[model samples]
Target: MTLHRLILREIRHRKVNFALSVLGAAVAVAAVLSTVGALRAYDRETEAVIDEMEEATKAEMAKLEDEIRKSMKGLGFNLFIFPEGQDLSEVYAEGFASRTMPEEYVTKLAESGVVTVNHLLPSLTKKLEWPEQKRTVILIGVRGEVPIAHRSPKAPLIDPVEPGHLVMGYELHRSLGLKKGDTVTFMEREFTIDDTYEARGSKDDITLWMNLGECQEMLDMKGEINAIQALECNCATVDRLGEIRAELGEILPNTQIIETQSTALARAEARNQAAATSRAQIEAKEEQRARLRAEREKLAGWLLPVATLVSMIWIGLLAFINVRERLPEIGILRAIGVKGRTILGAFLGRAVLAGVVGGVIGVVVAKVVKLPSVDSGPIIESGEWIAAIVTAPLLAALAAWLPSLAAAQRDPAEVLRHD
Candidate 1:
């Protein structure tokens, strides 16, 4: 009979051993594919989770930034820029600058492309006696906020005082018995009451606002401004004042910058807290993903090898039993002049057949079954399928190697005598 026929007859004669060997191979292949598929599925899940987290982080950052912007707007201008050599103590006591600088200095800063400060308002302020009201009040002059060349324009925190009009403080208007549209004479100039402010417990309550050109002309200090009020940006650096000074020094070399720490510090702290919260959330998510990945890896690290080892040992044991049971047949065949190589081929062929059939069934089952750990579904690559299929037969061949060798090298004379 042919080697193929011999292998077929041997499988038919001992169907139980052949079926057990095939089952072992099937379980091994299925286990390996399941493990690999689970890992791939987990990797895909992680990537999707990270992508979603990134989008959420961006949205959260945008919302926080909007909140900060609104908070800073409410805080108002926190930086005051005055001409160099002007005493801050005098400014504090008198509520206005004693010295003056060119009005064009503010325009120069606006055009300088400085990003650290914004909302540039140039004003000429003085403490003068109101002749008509017979009250001593501070006079302030403002035109409007200057727009930066490189940045988007923002709404002015303080509105501009129109020409020939006056925005009176609460104390000046209330004490003087004046209301909107009422005429007031100051420094011999007639100004209609354009707006009246509510009571503010500050120097602003005792102040009078007028047009810049009109105030400069009235004070006989034309084309001059004493102070430039601006809002400083809350950035990542702690040395904000120093940075602003350096930038201003480069643009307006003869100007001095003063910060209102109460407002600036509040804005900075709010921004810092928001940033910290964002970082903490992202870090926590990353740590969680890493922990899950480590757990999966730990489980896979031992499970695959143990399954493969058990399958190999089971196949090896089954081959040994088959060899012992077929010894008489092998001895008779040897007496009939069958070669050792034919016997070895017959045993090895049965193992290869079992491996091929089991590998096909395992691959199909792995594709259909879903792992409990995987949420989406089974994930298997073409390369993994090829590896499993190709490795199954090789594994079976290796497991049967020792048993097949012993069968091929058996002493026919001793085997027959023992039978």
Candidate 2:
């Protein structure tokens, strides 16, 4: 028989092995595709979260700057005096009042007539906005100390009129639905929201405000205030917190210096750094996981095609072995004049027929059940498709080559001796 006929005969006879190898190649291709798909999905989600954080950061920084501007009015000094005609000597002696700043400074202000202290109640506009939240809007108290008067009504954009009146920010006023001269409640007490003045670039414009005396009574914080934002002579003057703490200790010994900026900023920066580090670590772990997952998927992919290749090779092996076993038959043919190349050709033909049938079956099966391409990564490249298809066959041919070559190497004389 012709060498081609001999190869075709063996392939047609061993249909089962031919079928298995074709299936194996299809599985490997699918696994490769699935891994590429998963990476694409992960990239999109992380991008959105970063954008939200950026906006929030800018808003918070603006709040800090406003607090600094407000605090600058105090110039690190203020003098508190008794009410008009109240006789400071008696008030000082009777223990009803005590000076928090330097006693000398109060004397200087009183002598110069530049510093004056007065007590009055007034309502403040809301500084924060929350829809349907009129009740949540609150009036924060301000002091009528030197810092308060030194406050640039023109610069901050707050309109502080006579006793019992304060300004509101446009943003705050619009939210609370209150108008100038309107009334609002504080601790169930009432005051007029008068003379709304614009505080440039501050959300505090919404705050309807009154003097410290009103805040102390309304908030029920008599002799106790939540915070003090005294103006420093210079932003440079309050460089070190320890110095501020020491100077504040000497000036306002009993009052606590609560921080809205320096201390808070230090802690915030530390936390931001830590969060960045954690995100990087998480990203590292994710990258490692992606690699591992890809490997497992590739392995899973090989199972079917590899099994198919092994089965087909085994089928081809059995046929070749049987032919080797029929040495007397093979020897007679050789003796009659069949060439060694023809004998080798016969075994190779079996592998080719099986490979083609299996490849075609694999290709058809892969096509029918073809999974849609999954999006993977921020950028999926075009090379992946070409690589997967091209590699599958090369692997299959290699798998088929070894066993077929082994079948061809047997000595014809030895095979005939067995007969």
Candidate 3:
């Protein structure tokens, strides 16, 4: 019989041996497929988790930004820019600046591309006697905000006072028994009360607001302003006031800038806290992903190799047993002038056949089986399928190599005598 026929006969005669050998190969292939699938699953899961984290972080950041914006509006202007020669002690004690700067100074600062400040408001403020009401009050003149060329237009923090109208303080209007739409005369100019403010327990309670040009004309300080109120930008650094001062110095050399420490600090802290919270959340997710990947790698690192080695050893052991059982057949064939090469081919062929069958079985099991670790289905690639099919036969051949070689080299005389 030919070597092919011989191999078939041997497999048929030893069905148990062939089945066991095929089982070993199938086990190895399945182990490899499971390990690779699990790792791929982990990678996919990590990507999905990172995507979710980014979206969540963005939503949280937006919410924090909205909250900070409302808080800033409540805090109001934090920086006061006035003439360099003015004394801050007097300004604080009297609740208004005594010195005056050119109104154009505010325009220069706004258009200077200075990014450290926002909401530039030029106002001419003074404590004067209301001749018509026979009482003293602080008068503040305001106009529309100057647009910054480099920044988008925002809603004005303090609305502009319209001409011929007045926004009176709570105490001023209450004590004078004035209400909205009532005519009030100040500095010989007639102005109608447009609105009255609620109690604020501050000098604002005794203050009167009017149009900038009208106030300047009445005070005979046309084109001049005593103060420029602004809100400082919430930058990452703590030296924001210093930076604003430096920028303003270059633009308005005769002006001095002062910061409201409580408001400025609170704004900066709120922004910083929001940023830190977002960063921490993303970092936590990244660290968790890294940890999971390392664990999966460590598990697969030993698992695949251990499984392969055990299958190889099992196939080799079974081949050795098959050789022992076929010694008499080998002896009879050798005596009839069958070459050792034919004997070797027969043994190796049987192993290769078993390998091919086992590989097919392994592929099917891998496709059907679902691992607990992987949430998604089995991730089998074309390359993995090829490796499973190709590696199995090679492993089987290698396992049977030494046993087949020993059988081929056995002496017919000794084999027949032992049989």
Instruction: Using TM-score, give the best candidate's number.
Output: 3
Deviation from native of the Cα of residue 178 in model 2, angstroms: 14
Model 1 bad stretches (over 4 Å): 8-19, 81-109, 119-146, 152-229, 238-240, 246-256, 262-273, 324-328, 377-382, 409-419
Scored by Cα lDDT, where does model 3 land? 0.84
Each model's lDDT comes to 0.83, 0.46, 0.84
Poorest stretch of ten by lDDT in candidate 1: 68-77
TM-score of 1: 0.65
Q: Candidate 2 regions off by >4 Å?
A: 1-14, 24-264, 270-274, 277-336, 356-419
How much lDDT does candidate 1 score? 0.83
lDDT of 1 by residue, 285-370 (tens): 87887798788889878989998999989999998898999999889888888899888888888888888877877788778778
TM-score of model number 3 = 0.66
Taking the tens digit of each residue's C-alpha lDDT, what string does model 3 give over 1-419?
57787788878888999999999989988888977876787788778888887888788777776667555644545678889999999987886789999999988888889888777889999998888878889998999576667899986666789999999999999998999999987877788998998897878899999999989998999999999877667664557677877877788889887775557677667767877877787788779888877987898899889888898889989999999988998999899999999889888888888788888788778777778867875678988888899899889989999999999998999998977
Poorest stretch of ten by lDDT in candidate 2: 115-124
The residue pairs that clash in candidate 3, if any, are none
Per-residue accuracy of model 2 over 1-419 as CA lDDT, tens digit each: 56676555655665554455444455444444444444444334334434444445455545644554444332222222222233446433532222222223322332332221211112222223333344444455555433233433324322344446655556666766777888755444565776565545553544455775565555454554333333332223234444544554454444443333453344345446555665665566566656755765676477545654565455445555555554565666566667666665665555444445544454444334423332333232346555555655555555555554554555667766766
TM-score of each: 0.65, 0.40, 0.66
